[model samples]
Target: MLEFVVCFTVVAILGGLLLQRLWHYRAEAERAAVQMVIANIRSALEIKVAQANLPDGSLDFTFLTEENPLNLLKVKPVNYAGEWYRPSGADIGAGNWCFDRADKTLLYLLNNVNSFEDSQTKLLKFKVKLTRLPHSPAKPSGAPETLGVAFEQVKD
Candidate 1:
């Protein structure tokens, strides 16, 4: 009778521990997913930069405009006619991107630009950013092998 009671107690404790671990993992997975989305955005930009083979070997600002020679590399058209991006059903496509020429501090307009802690947290977050260099490399082959190292620091 004593052994039976001890076994039940052990099982109950183990079950509680498992449930706790599962809950913690669920939250962590969600955070990781959000991070992945941010990471992908950076990677896609790098891919495009690589496609634009510059004369001096660095990605030029000219590649960013409508006259971008590597238009085929863009998922979302680099040069559109007269239309901004259409919003997805759940605001997935609603994002803004801008660059500061003076400071070179590119500002990615995120959907949920929270100022510290706020009560209004959404189900998902959207964001974008600019990746640039000091003076543009003398030659940028735009190779994945070349750009992969820059992003590796941010990935899990």
Candidate 2:
């Protein structure tokens, strides 16, 4: 009986360790997905700015009208940080989505859009806000902290 008890304890320890490893891997994968989203959005935003007939954060046009310039590109997630082999709701939408070009200084930075409509499908809506760097329209800061997991496996 003593020997069996010892063996069970060992197995429990091993299971715990394995669970920890899996969690670490999952967290890393999540981080990568966030980064990919940031990169893609940044690139699209740059293009919009270049073709923008108004200003950098000008929302006064058709595709990016000053009133509703939130429908820029059909934000879609083709990848999920080289992880999650399945289609993660952590992706973008299937239609054009605009960027909030309205003084992304304090509010924008604080409330950036990390992902698109897809993130909301899995109830992970508003993962993070992707904001443009201040005084540096040519540059952007893709902070990792901003891109965090919003949902977790809920317990019954």
Candidate 3:
């Protein structure tokens, strides 16, 4: 009887530890998925900038900031919930992407909130901003300055 009880307790403890490890892994996977989406968005933004630069020697970055960055992508992620103005938590839900038009920020509501560290609100917010590279000495004086796009994390 004593041996049976000890074996049961060991099995129970092991089961609990296994469950905790699984949750940690699930949170890590969620973080990776979010990063992948952000990377795709960044690539799309770069393509848009290049396309714009081809047409004009001077690029106006003001419009880019106000525009929805997701629109630049040829195909958005399946999890994307689309754009919203002043979206509430219930409206956005977890494991979804939403663009908050009110502040021109993209929001990702995390489903695995246990280990997500980007925000305390269990949401990750990002903003697209224009980036300018320093003038290169090798470039000709008349050459247009290099411009790029940056995906910056925003605190909510």
Top lDDT hit:
3
lDDT for 92 (candidate 3): 89
Ranking by lDDT: 3, 1, 2
lDDT score for residue 121 of model 2: 30
Model 2 RMSD vs true structure: 13.5
Mind giving the per-residue lDDT tens digits that candidate 1 earns over 21-94?
A: 88666656544544544466556656656655555556443434332221333343331122223333233332
Tell me the tens digit of each residue's lDDT in model 3 across 1-156: 999999999999999999999989998988888888889888887777777788664477678799888888888888888899989878888999999999999998889776567467788899998788899889999997787778888874
Rank by TM-score (best first): 3, 2, 1
TM-score of each: 0.39, 0.40, 0.84
Task: Report the number of clashing residue pairs per model.
Answer: 4, 17, 0
Runs in model 1 deviating more than 4 A are 1-3, 53-124, 130-156
Report, for every candidate in turn, its global Cα lDDT versus the true structure.
0.41, 0.37, 0.85
RMSD to truth, every model: 10.9, 13.5, 2.4
Selected candidate, larger TM-score, 2 vs 3: 3
